[model samples]
Each structure stands twice: as structure tokens, then as C-alpha cells.
Target: MNEILNNLLSLHSESEIAEFKEARNSFDFNKLGKYFSALSNEANLKKLKCAWLVFGVKDNRTVVGSQFRTNLQDLQSLKKEIADKTTSRLTFVDIHEIEHPDGRVLLFEIPAAPQGLPIAWDGHYYGRDGESLGPLNLEEIERIRRQNRASDWSAVTLPSASITDLEPAAIEQARENFFQKNPKLVQEAKQWDIATFLNKAKLTINGQITRAAILLLGKAESSHFLNPASATITWILKDRDGLERDYQHFGCPLLLGVDEVFHKIRPLKYRYMKEGTLFPEEVEQYDPYIIREALNNAIAHQDYELGGKITLVEFEDGRLCFSNVGQFIPGSVESVIQTDAPESRYRNRFLIDAMVNLNMIDTIGSGIRKMFLIQKKRFFPLPEYDLKDNRVQVTVIGRVVDMAYARKLAEYPNLTLEDILLLDRVQKRKPLTDDQAKYLKSLGLIEGRKPNFHISAQIANHSGERMQYIHNRALDDQYYKELILAYLEKFGTAKRVDINGLVLDKLPNVLDETQKYNKVKNLLQALKQKGLIESEGKSWRMSKKI
Candidate 1:
């Protein structure tokens, strides 16, 4: 019932917060309780909000049609059974029934264990070790217990930090940015001194310089105040081969360092002719706001405690990459886009607040989505975020990868940003959810099965992909069978190889040779079933009556 179920179903295999089971006909009730405990505890340790136990699916994630607890009342009763045995009377948050094309699916939403408390079933604590259920080990139990007690690294005050430790120019810039964001405060901002300005901008808390203050406004040499936590941003230029061509590093007063980094990379003008326009439009290689927002985001969200510096790489082509050392506080980029609100938790709460107050970044959580939208408007590839190994890496492309497809998507004003995003995946030949594939197919905007789709003629003409569409298009099976019949009538007898050779090139180019051969095989079977053709040994011939 939850939208997250769609994302989970798209997962190729079980995860710490998710499990799949066939459960066809029925399943043991106690096994469900054990899984509930395992998933809930695993979710907490992994810093996830909830876990899932999916029924009607196998270990390989195949939907084999589950019949477990078919009766609504019986399904409802299982909740009480689980609660009676769990450590905190914890049962499923909700049991959702989804009607999937393959079969009926049951999704059990299990809330993560409360902070500092490990979930248990019948007095035995449980957790997921990879994909298998097991006891919550002492180390893992302690990890969950320590989650809430962990201190905020960015909020700590540096005793030796003072107003002199901050760069005067950086402070002036912060004030100017603040005024620009709040034009009404112009005269009032001029009246206040440095201390008042710092406090008002949320850079310093009660005149005590915080780690955030030193990181953003402190002088270059003042970085030692946040010892072991590097207040550095590195910019590197790479050639086409990905070899480092040049590099520059900036430290402290990140407010100014952000600009220094921006200056190091060039944003050249690029020209492109639109599909329907006679004239060409010229735009900057990279949008300035996007560049600033990306750099500021890296500074605001970097895990400085890790002692790793934020890195920006500019490719010789037209791409920029920004990476910060830390797990994305929101867990997933999808959560950031879908929530569209300030996150409840942040790795650098104080730094983020200060940056927002200084107008360095937006606080409404729409910044990332806005970045995606801006690129979409420019008819360029959407920004790609790769979050893994406790790091968040984002890549922004300046030019269009497929000009026609990008233009087609840009011209469609009625399409929602989300729809455009999914369509972008279709154009790139990426995997799609079954529901997504079905919706696009119904609109005649896409063709082919999941994971291997092509833009359909309905939208391809506008995208300048009409020829591509024709090449990818599939004709009716009856037509292919008719072609086979005609071929046999002329040749009298033909080997399987001959039939394959005759039809392979006619099949959609989107399909591989194996798929093309398979298509011919299916057409041959259909012809034999209709008695229009008969196979003798390895060859096929027209039926005597026909």
C-alpha cells in the first residue's frame, strides 16, 4: 500500500530491512514472528525507519502467488499473535495486500526497534545477518543502544575559537548574502557589529564559536581549532582518460572556498539546435546556481568528523562530480525527493542551519529536486547520485547525452517532474518497475519489456527518434507467421536456419540475436499449431492441404 513497496519490489534480492517468501497456500505463524523480530532489529541497527516482510515471493524474488492468510480475519488475528510474543508487544505496523500481475502480494510493514531497544520474540532477540535470520549479537545490540546517545560532531564549541579566528572578508560575504536573502534587513544589518551578525546568522551560538562557525567563517590557519576534522575542499580537473590534469585545495572559511572552487572549474557556453526550431540556442556549460548549490550542499552535509575532505572533480568533457565522506543522513535520495520537507535528522544540523541563514543553501529540502528539475529544463541528463560505502557522490552533466530524447521530454509541459525522470530512464534503457512499464506502455510512449525498453513512435517523432522507433518496433505475430508461410511456399522446403535467416533481420533491432532467433522459433510453433506449415525432421514445408 505504501509507495516504498514499489521501490522494495524493484529490489533484486532481500536486504536487511526486506525479505521475500513464496508462502503459497499458507505459512507457519511462528516463523512470521521470528522474521518480524529479525527485520525490526535489523532496521534499527542499519538506521532505517522500517523493515519489510514480503509474501507471495520466493528467495529469488519470483512472485509465485502466495495464498497465506487469505481470509481477512485470519490475517488480522496474526497481529495479536505477534504482539503477545514480541519484547514490546510490537506487531506489524500494517499489513497491505497488493494485487500484482504475477499474483497477490502481502507486504508486512514492521517499524524499526525504538531507539536503544533491540526487538525480541519470545524473550529471544533477533537480527538479520545478511539475508538470514539470527540472534542479535552483543556488538550489534550495543550499536542500536548507542544510536541516540551519539554526540553531534558539528554542534560542539571550540573553546579557543574567537572573532579574530574568522576571516573578515568571509564574514562580509556572509552578511552580503544574508542581506540579499533578506532585503528588508539591509539598514538593520548595517547597524550590527561582527558578533551580532554572526549570532543572527546562526554561525556562532551564544558567542561561543562552534565547529560550524570555524568551518564556514574561520581563517585559513584557524582550521586547527577543529583538529583531526579537516575543514578542506579539494577541486581536481581530469582529462578525457580520467587522469588528473590539475588540482587546487582550499581550507577554512568555506564560505569563500566555495567560490574559489567554482572559479577553478570553467563553465563554457554550449550551443544546440532544438528539434522544431530553425535557430540554435546557446547556454552555459554548467548552471551557476547548480554549481553553487552542489558545492554548498557538500560543505553543509560533509562528515568532517571522518577527517576526509570534500572532493570536486571536473571532467574535460562537461561533467562535474562532488563527493562527501559520510552516509546520506536521509538514508536514500528517493526519501529526500519524495519527502520534500526538512529532514528530521542531519549529519551537520548546526552547519546546515548556518548555511541556510547565510543563504548558502535552501532549507526546504527541495534543493536536490530543484537541481534535477533545472537539468531537465535544459534538456540535459538528470543528475546522478551514487550513495554507497558511507559516501554520497553526485554527477551533473552539462550537455545532453541524447539530444532528441532530451528535447522531446523538455517540450512536454504536462509531464510531472517524476514522470519525466522515469521517462529519462526509459530513454537510457534502464530497468523500470512493472507498474512503470505498464503505465508507459498504456500511453504508447514506450515499447518492449522491463529493463529493455525503447521510446515509442507516439513520442519518438517529437524526440527525433522516429527511425529508432521503427527499428525497435515489433510487428504482430500473425504477420511473422505469414512471412514464414510465404517463404515456405516459394522454397518448398527450408531448414530452421533458413527460416531464422529470413526473419532475424525483420525483427526489431532492439532485440539481440538470441531474442530474434527465439521470436522465429515462436512464430514457427504458431504456424505448426495452425496447420499452415509442417516440420519434417529439421526442415519446414507448407501443409499439403494449404
Candidate 2:
């Protein structure tokens, strides 16, 4: 344990937690909140468990520790001050005191930023670029505040350098992709030299080379700009329960690493019903759209400023989890998918620029939104975000997940993205706010009392019987069509009352007496119009089409 602590001894850097170093050892209450918001949000973006604010540390990276104040009251005071300005009345877990053999350390372990809302510092939002905190640049701030965490990261480039240092192979690939994306550039493309093209591609810094230059074009061994932090993505295959089964790591030039990590991520064959039909159809376990967005977003948006690798975990039961080292810039997944707004900025401009030029991701703010759209079209559970320990974790269930649940969700097209995000929290067995629980109950998706929610049996298909679905479909307009056809083929309908009795149990799960009565009335009217079944006074009989 001490050995682990020994390695962590040199971990006073703000990049570790997304928190900033206070130029002055003493800062007031509002400033404390600002640091918490800055560090916590950045931690989530960086994908770390916690970002920290130490009382004593030299700019040179030495752990001098502090002597200003070490009393428990002072530590507790920090939490109260932050709570006043933040939503959810946030507070730190604890202000830690670590006495190294040489110096005394005060580690304020800030939690991850709250999901669905940006951590505003005293009514104003804040953000950090590297180590500096400003008014949280509007473009980048809005993108993250709305949960566009999957926005491009690689487009950000080091401003001081140009294209000369970029690798030739990566540049050549970029040019090919550019010509392919904009075919009109084909004739003019050949006319421009590499430098002119790189300039046009925004891969160069005013005709100079940048660290981003080395990252994308420099040899694998030439990545000195990102010292300590490796620009590598590691894929780990796992079983259904998340136990590791296999692993592989990938790195720049990103053009190759992106494809390498993708190949390593195992895709499974899957099947589902067509939107309006009830039948079997197949798609890759990992939606190609989802997989591409996730993989590219991880590369484009990762905070290489933090020294860690992006992780992709593929589970046997058909779930792929993509995580990277950085706080989720778009704050929460809910806001991103719900709002129709565009994201303004990214973390890795250089990397994202290259991907955009390479046709890997959209520079406009539609990445996560598109991911949500694809999942919804497939009737899949929405993606989830885990924001504890200062890191961001996104989990996408790839298989035909919970058919009944998917069907029930399809029934309610009005369900809000916020509600889905909250349900995701519940499914993970994480604590939900009272508002969240109330919302679930209102939708009849959950039952039972506080602390224990039994998914409504109707939606859960608790009996797990195909007959339950058969009966349930009898009452749905869409399902009614199928049943009318099925029932006529099985037992020629004789009495309207009999057909209602046959499907009464299914009605019990979904509706009250009035809804069931109305459903039966509607089905009878439709069958008669279709000339399949007609009512003779109070009785009904099937048409002798044969």
C-alpha cells in the first residue's frame, strides 16, 4: 500500500484532478468554489476519479505542502462555501491530510461534476485550458454545458508551430480523405504543395509546426510534446460481467490507431424488429455509427494534457464501454442529446481538425446527438454516464437489450432525455435524486416504495413468456393488425366478447378498465372496416374470404 502511495506521492499536479493551483496559498470562499467547478469538470473530461487542490505545492512540481491552516473546521468550511454557490448543494468528500516523510499535504479530493448540469461557480461558469482558468470560453463552455462531451478533441492545435514537422504518411492520408470528402478539391488539390495543403487543412500553425504536428505527423517515437502522457488507446475485451478477457493498445499517427482500436473491438451480430413491424432483423452488436462516434470522439476529445490512455471494453453479452482520460466536456449526456444546439469548441483542436479532414467526425456539434438518434431508431437503451472519482465513463449496451423495455419505451415517444438519463442511473444501482424517482413513478415504469423500485411488470414482461407479448399486441393498434391476421388464421373469430376475453390478461398490465374497453371497441371497428371480422348485432363473425 505504501508503495502505491509512493507512486502517488508525486501526484500534486492539477492535471491529475482538473483543479487549478491557486497562485496565492490563501483563497476566499468564491474562489474555492471556482477551483472545485474547474477541477471537478475537468476531471470528468479527463476521465479521472478526482481532481485536487493542494494548499502547498511549488510551480516546479515539488510537494512543499502547506502551513496556512490544518484544522478540521477550516477543511469543513471549504465544503459549506462551495455548496452555497453550486447546484445539488455540492460538497467535497473530505479535505485530506497526508503527512509525507518530508512535507505535510492538504489534498481536497473534488468529486466529478454533476451530470445534466454544469458546475457553475457562484452563478458564473468556469473552465480550464491546461492550467489556466478563464470565464470558461463561451463556445467550449456551451458545448460542454449542454452535454456535448463527445465533441471533437483533435481539432485543437498548438498555435506556435506549423506543418513542416507533421508526418508525411499521416499528411498523405489526410489529403486523400480531404479529396474524397470534397471531390471538387481533386483537380485543385494536386496543384497545391504539401505545405499549402496543410495550411488549407489547418494542420499547420500559420505555416509553422506545432506539438499537434508531432502527435499526428511525427514518428511514434517523436511524441515529446505529450511527455508523461501517451496518446495511445487501449482496447480490452471482457466477459459479460466485465472481467477482462483480452487487451491491445494503439497510438498515433491517429489515422492508423483509430482503425487499429476499431478492429480490436469485437463486434457481434444482432437482430431486431423493423420500426413498424414485429419480425427478426440483424445488425452488428455494436452499431457501426455508435462505434465510430465513440472511438473517434475518444481520440478527438481526450485531454492528452493528462497522461493516460483511452480505454475500450467489449463485453461478451454485447456491451461496449468507451472511456478516456478526461472530464466529459459536454457536462452530461442528457443535455447533449436533448438540445438541438451546436457545440462550439473542443479539447484537442489539432487532433479533431485532422479527423474532420479525415472524415472521421463532424466539426459541428452533432456527435453525441447523432449517437442518441441511432440508438433510438434501433430501440436501444440510451448511453449512460458515470461521473464519480472525477472521471467520465460512458456505457453503450450493444445487443438487443431488454426487448420488452424497448417496446415499452417505444410506446411512449414523449419520454424526455433527462428521464432516460435518470433511468440509466437507476439501472446502474446508483442513487437517484427524489425528482428522478418521482418522474419514474409518474411514467409507471417503476413501482414499490422508496429504496426499492420493481420495474413495472407490464414493461418488464416479468413472466418472460412469448404469450404475454402475443396478448399485449392484441390491444395495440400496430399489434392489433398482427393479431387480427393471426387470430383469423388460428380460430375464425366468432364473438367480439370472446376475443376480448382472450386478451383481457394483457390489458390488465397496460390499462385501466376504460382504456381496455376503448381498445376493444377500436379493434372491432378496424376489423369490420378491413372486412376480416364483422359484428352481427352484439356478436362478431370472421369473413369467409376463402
lDDT of each: 0.83, 0.65
The runs of at least 3 residues in candidate 2 whose Cα sits more than 4 Å from the true structure, single-residue gaps closed, are: 1-165, 240-243, 271-279, 410-448, 451-546
- Clash count for each candidate, listed in order shown: 0, 44
The residue-by-residue lDDT of candidate 1 on 1-546, one tens digit each, is 747667877897788889998899888877888899999998887778789999998888777778888999999888998988986466787899888888999999998876555777888888887898888899998987565447567788877779999999999999999998889999999999999998898888899899998999999989999876799899999988999999989998899999999988885987886555622488888999899988999888876644678999999889999998766778877778778898777767778888888889978889998998888778888888998655789999988787667667755757777777788887666789999888888877787765568877778776667787888888777788888888888889999988888888888877777778887888888888888889899999998867
Tens digits of per-residue lDDT for model 2, 1-546: 234234444555445353423233455666777878877777665656666676555654566656646677876786787777774455686777667665666667777664334567767776687767766667655655555344333334555444544567888877888888778788998889987787777666566655555665665765655564577778888886778889887666766677677777665677775655543488677777788788888777666644557888888887778887666766766667666575565666566776677687876677887777667666677776686533566788875556665665566566666666665454444566688788788877665445544455555563343454443332336575566567756775556667777655555343447767777788778877878776667776676653
User: TM-scores, in order shown?
Assistant: 0.65, 0.54
What are the candidates' C-alpha RMSDs? Answer: 16.2, 15.6
